[model samples]
Target: MHGLLSAYSPLSKVIRKKGIPYLCSPMPPSTRTPYTGSSRKLVLAFDVGTTYSGISYSILDPGQVPEIKGVTRFPAQEKVGGSSKIPTVIYYDKAGKVRAVGAEALRESLRDTIEDEGWVKAEWFKLHMRPKAITSSNPMDKIPPLPAGKSVVDLFGDFIRYLYSCAKLYITESHANGTQLWSSVERTIDFVLTHPNGWEGGQQQQMRKAAIQAGLVPDTIEGHARIRFVTEGEASLHFCIQSGLTTEALKSGGGVMIVDAGGGTIDLSAYGEGPTKGTFEEIASPQCHLQGSVYVTIRARTFLENYLRESKFVEDVEAMTEYFDKSAKLTFDSNPLFIKFGGARDRDPKLRIRGGQLTLSGTEVAAFFEPSVSCIIRAIKMQCMAAKKPISSLFLVGGFSASEYLFSKLKEELAPLGPNVCRPDSHLNKAVADGAVSFYLDHVVAMRVSRFLYGTKCKVNYDRKRADHVLRFAGVFNDVDGIPCLAGSFDVILPKDVQVSETQEFRKHYIQKAFDRIGLEAATSLIYCYRGALEKPLWWNGSSDFSALCTIKADTSKISRCLKPRLTTWGQTYYEMFFDIVLSFGLTELTAQIAWLEDGVEKRSPAKIVYDVDA
Candidate 1:
């Protein structure tokens, strides 16, 4: 009796509407300083998730404080004025052309259009970019597949293009002189894209490629430079700070934990205030898990299939599950959930179906949420154990946080952990979209923990006294100076779980030997990341723990001009080039450069990061 009787609920109450109100309250005045940039510009943040997406923007005027705003209006939303978020869904016709997108695809009137036009639906497409290391609790086969003849990047291009157009329309219509304001900053606009914490450079490369394809930026170096990446966990922390959710904790000198429970992945991150006021640093390595709200829906679907196997209405399981997802899943409290899917003609009393309604016990519904709940609890404990400082408060924010059941469950289980657990009362789903903008404007996070060991493979001088060196001596070779060396040695520049500052640089020096100057014309250093549990990785050969993370391409032609030929003890002449592979990891993204000395002065050249497309 406490359950709703309709699948198509009011759009405002829909859990997928992870959007802000038409007019968001301005950020607190003291949260940030006035803009100091030389010229006016715009920053647009896109929070593209598996089930829903949103856009937030800030116009930076020199010497004036900036405010973050959301694109409240979107095409096909039920409301006439605006919505906080739009469904991450699209429809493609037989020709592979986009027929409808976002909230438009969910319109009831589009049913006939889809049926007559043979349109294919694509939802939860973002999960396709998930890293191979993170496995989902639910079966991948249950998730919808991409449209025919379309790759994951293609899907991203189409969706990002739609979000861009929506932002344009909303900005122009919502503000004073909106057209003029947009035109002034059109070319120099900066974009920040948020992704899960588990995503690596490979996923970032795919996203950047999609941005170029979507026409958000040109296919040039400068255009690509305008794009930035941030983890959903870090972004949420910024949002929590700006929204004044963490003020009390910060005042008491206690660290905070941010749990971003979204559609596809839940990201966990812990932070402590920096040495300087108004700044923060990561106290623990961030974690991302594939268990999220969508998994609960998947589990529900599987349960329905088996529970109704012997019933005559088994063919209607899909419709029933859809109803349960859109309503019962979000409104579930400690009561029975009644999913209304059909008319009064549908009656199966033996299976607890009457008056077109299907009733499910609260315990059965809780089982669907058990996997996600357990994953979060385990991750939180691990983070607490790994944190350098004690955590005193936990902030829950994201689309999935709307579930009252999930919120109560987390608070109850975490009571004994000594951290206060709570979530924002409103606009919780748009935390990432708004927080992404805050991350760009206010440099709150100063230090971050490295998630893995990053370094380069090099050769080590052979020492017969060492057991490791003796075992690999068979592959030893004589260097230019006739010194015996063994390959496959790992030079760790940065170890896992170490705190690093934003300005910190990790440099690894190496000397390359070539027979001629032409061999030193160009240099390509392949950077590798170790995923194994070894405290100190010494070798990479014959081990599956190592993988190519990225390649840093540098022009060593300048070094060739400074080097001269040197004769080995065996009377062989060779050129020796000295250089250093410099890497920066504290920022949201990784950057690298090559450095060497020219005439007693250090010269540095920017290195291009290239990731394997298949990775």
Candidate 2:
């Protein structure tokens, strides 16, 4: 509940004093190496965005470098001329069956049938799966409700299956001996799914489950291991590298920041060159903002609703908004724009409607884009300040970055800051998809920064002298050892914004005292993610900012044999066992393991991670 600035002051000063040597230290080369596996394998990357989605894949042949390719051709989109993405739209019939998807949902021929059949159209359903922390800061009224009888996971599963089909067809038709090539590696293909930077372990778990439901992988441990995750920010970084967008900045030794301005979230991440060649290390914790291209359309809708409230065409506002989004939103600049809302007979001079066309002033259009532009600027400034080194270049790439006004505003406002802003000449919408492939192949990022304080709640020895401890008298309880203890004590395993290497493991030892030997046969650690501003929180205290992230449970029947029974001062028998909860956060998803020493030798067991049931 305290000010965050106070906690960051000391760390900021230390970072400034030490120059963050960890960020720039020498690291082992993660440069793109030839595939060394025994046989041929395929790696597919899917960017299932809120408004659009794309697929990128690589065929890994032993001793040969993998090549990344996009699924350029999709059903109902053959005439689009090598389009790298398709609309993230779906229509469901009354029986909860998928009637249409992607580009097929937009076909003009199905319009009448869709309306007459009462099929529900779903768009921006990905936003429903976004972390609660993000939805709390953004308005949810603009987000449409999911179709009846369909969960967000079902939506994801359906879309993923569609994209998977597209990938299969593209690979089969585009390559030489295409049919044989696909059939050869169909059983063990690996998948890399990209998500916004704000998504965490719980979101990743849900996505994994959806993938299983879609049959991209099986519902088993090995099948789960085949799917990997990468954030949009980091994936964009890899895409920039593959496109040769950051060559000069990497050579200059200054940090580089990637602003992935997509449909639903604008993700920002900063990175610096490692001491070794072709190695990158995160210099600051990544950030994701809800202000994106879709929000601009929402703002425009809000404006039209108010402006047309007194007119007879108020019922037509939704149609007009959709038309504007498709026709004028992306191409609008400092020019008068017109939106066709009705026929020639629907003329109204007062409302600037003539011949069915509704005219919009350039200023009014600019107002709709102002909030998203400002959000990007503020996020960029925050990243620059938080980065360990000076950020010299900013790479802007995403579906939203294609907007001239958004890009122009960002370049103009950021010019004074000295970082050169650049957007690749290649397809901006394909960044995340392509970058995810690069992430799987190049593996250049050697380290990452933790975004939250991850820890577990445990009982701590009670201190009667502390005022905070006395305030929670009702929650205090005596352990089996007859010692006063307070539950809900936070034991932090990793602090926010700290640099962690790929192989880094954080461990916190804990002891459990039980009355009988049966209780020591197994143990479960409830991990909680703290989002509050406090630097070192002492207790959970039922704070709103704390959520149970996951539970790590392991069988301790073997380790329990090492414990010894003892008697407390009150003549009660008790048994105690000690173990460490180990966590790794450097990868895209968090992993947990339990470790305990047995007979002077260390033994480890894989602990099953169970996320919040309601998540």
Candidate 3:
């Protein structure tokens, strides 16, 4: 499953419902924070891949092109022309204090383990953030336990803080070594974090929370980064369309399916080129799956461990890991290939390797790659077959997208289906980050397919005029003529896969039912966003794909509405208050507003989105 739909969602807490920054949205601010001095502007993009992460940027100017820098400067690591990708590793002490991050963490933790120390490496900790539920029996239980007292969110925050600090320094300090060379003066950095497209509001919300906690946003300190998000697929699409990289069919307004195969998730979205360059119309709702390159590595590691059981090679984890990192994960061949790790004295006559390297055969490696690769192939095939229009192109992008073996496998299977498959000639691995910068320049997708059925739960009146026994006895939140009227009934605001524009809005009026002594507060709105491909999920009970995200609350106390006891048409006396709930859609996040209208004047009251943390 695509592991992102957080915000009172049923997925993991790492990603939950995304709340758009009220300050940045076009909507009037309910409350305003004091402004500090403005700083210089720069656009930064971060691709925080599960296996590895990267950073890229462009100036805020319209004429500039984005650049992906080689980020090789971590504490205690020498610059080897800097690498575009950094291992997403973090090391913490016995007390759960973070010690190192990225390449440094990977390099030091192995050293410490060899010497038997307190430093424990949380390798692939990103897996803990999966948006899907898992039991103790799941393989995720095998991921290295984080040190005592630190939650996954805490660690991810620390990692982001470290990365953000480093990136800020690098952007400001580096010069003359192929760096973009910005002024040393303090500058406002705008970030576009890329994630799998299939993720929902909750996942995005968690990212925003992490960023703020990481001090990348407002955290007591006068931070310069203004953060936002773009999905990995969207960023890749931006680069593809702008660089003239899509197949001819896609370039000329034909359909293209983007498969962003990254280290953690494979995100899919189908689109047709728009009349305008770099613009597209979504053909279907995006899809995401946990199948990614890390699965291949995991399979390979398990195979090696079992194959070398109790051997000296197995005992020396460092050597084995180095071999896997350098050799096993890179090669892809039909003819057998060998991964040789042991020294001359420990040589095995494995024909797959040349010049006496301890090795694993190509057959073993293929097995490792098959699970993820096969799943991806099936997904692409399904997407193409199900497309409303013929998919005339397939543009593969992401770190895994750069793999020769993956490319070859995709071509062999997908080429026969008749759409041209292509990739960027350069910067293949950094497209997501670079494209995120492009997305900041302008949104490329004209519209999006709604991934969920979003709406509210309101009370519906029972029909006394045509009362049935079922209606008379049914459970209800309110009653009329002694007939039960349900209040938990779902109301669809936006149906799934329907077009949503940057300027589109969903506004509805609801009445605040009587509570204790004349209500002093304005009415608050609760929005329920349900998953599933239902075009009309209006009446869906608590059957499936349903979750009550945190309530969208607006302070109506300022509007001065005196709750008057009034008689209803059904001869019921009640104190009723009326207010409106509004949701404005943006390219990535939704801006919400709750208002009280009086005498043709609208009061923009303070609004807050309370997330469903327990869900």
Candidate 4:
């Protein structure tokens, strides 16, 4: 029955678009344009976080003061106005309708009644969507259930839709007076959805589909609207760049690490520059998903639950559950337990549990999640090593990054590295989303690439217990002149960390000698393998191999043929590069050329080519 329903689902039909469109509309005549050279326009940036989401618009006009809203700013800046932090929560009412979202939703979740009348609060929801978590058989079964027959996906989609509607309403209210930022109704309301770097292709596609279904796009309204996906870490980097961190880092070409520790996940990325001309490069991509505040909170909750269980004050398990829920509702200021855990008082306090009262210390609460905290530190160290660069400075962002305990722990762990570690001036929660907005505006054509390569094949050692595969390099080739290049004979273009794009050409110089007069016979035997590094070959292990054997007619007129076929890596790079190239040629996705030929001859052949390394 489940299989039957899954077969009929819309997941299959929702195609992934290769590129995002850039929309620019004319400004209205009423408002005074900021620049005399170019028309002023506003771009809306939305940070759709796991625990909180916020939207802000930026205008190119110099006179405009962009209003900061939601949570408070760090360092208490005079110019920074409004709340900068929004709780990442969505609450459903008794009628299965979205009663509140963000901060309000968080407040509502504190009430016990919110949980009774089908009022659901999604906490650490994004974490549950991780690949490992989602692939689990009963991932959602452990979580609290919602309305009749509603899946986690459905509930999440509904909540997101509500958030989108609220964001739209906020935009509408702000622009009600026909302000300069929203003067041009045509393109004034573009939104950018920020996501984690680790989101898989399927997850991203699902989010896009959900956004469309939620009527978040302009198409859902009477006119056109634009919605874009921006990586959260990248967005925060943009914010840093805009705030002059990029300039400072560039001047010295010094290495810096940016850590975005949020409710759902912790993201870390490192940047540095090449030796000559200070050619900037992102040394390490965002890693460290386990370093989230949710884990810490869960650890605290577990300790409290265990304490309650041992105390025996509450006889029934159901009653204990209620107590746990109530205990979770206590804020740092209101909850005596939180105050004790936060080290506000000197001695440990006893809390009434299932049978009796148990005394616990702040140190004990902090020690409960030491393993999780260690995982974060290990991740940071791994990223630093992968970077192969010296770290000169470290910057922390996100809600969890602001935690005194987390900050102190990171400092203590990283103290030996002797780098300047500090937090950003802006609120950590809003940093990524805000940065992403600024990045989208400043670097409209920015593209990120991940490459895979094909190389020589050899026997690999397999460990059954550990499930590990170790690669062994067989041999190296000196030349390709007489090399009867068979199916498996290939090399990876860019290794694991090497970044290549569609617009950027990757070519391997191949020289082929006509062996016999066969009309495109052996030419079709040529197979191209796209891989990251040249050390390991990227051959398909099963039926759908990309290796192709090309057969070409041996004619004296076309004796010397050199082929430079453009290869595309799968995933984000392929989509981005393809879009850019197509747009550059003034061609749409439908109109793009699909076939490639060497000279005038058509290289028709089966894509799958099998080859024996010994042969």
TM-score-superior candidate, 1 or 2: 1
Which candidate would rank higher by TM-score, 1 or 4? Answer: 1
Write down the TM-score for model 1.
0.94
Model 4 is weakest, by summed lDDT over 10 consecutive residues, at 1-10
Cα lDDT tens digits, model 2, 484-576, are 999888888899899999889999999988988789888898888889999989887677788888899889888887788899997888998
TM-score per prediction, in order, is 0.94, 0.92, 0.82, 0.62
Better of 1 and 3 by TM-score: 1
TM-score ranking, best first: 1, 2, 3, 4
Model 4, stretches more than 4 Å misplaced? Answer: 1-41, 60-82, 93-96, 106-116, 133-157, 179-183, 186-188, 218-225, 273-280, 312-359, 444-494, 505-535, 542-615
lDDT of 3 by residue, 430-483 (tens): 778767776666466767767667888877665556554245445544442343
Tens digit per residue, CA lDDT, model 4, 1-615: 000000001111112222211111121122112322235555566676765666655544444423223223312123346465455566666566766666555442357767566566655566555544212242122333344544445555766665555544555465545443344543444556677766543354456556666655544433223656666766676655544454444345567777887766777777665332323346664564654655555555555556656544323334433333334222221113322122223222355221232344556656644655676788778877776467776777777665655666777898887655666543556787677665545432222334223222222223324322223123323211222122323344334465332244333333233223232123222322332223554443423233321111222222223422322332111110000001011100001111224455543221222232111
lDDT of each: 0.85, 0.85, 0.64, 0.46
Weakest ten-residue segment in model 1 by summed lDDT: 1-10
Cα error, residue 462 of model 1, in Å, equals 1.1
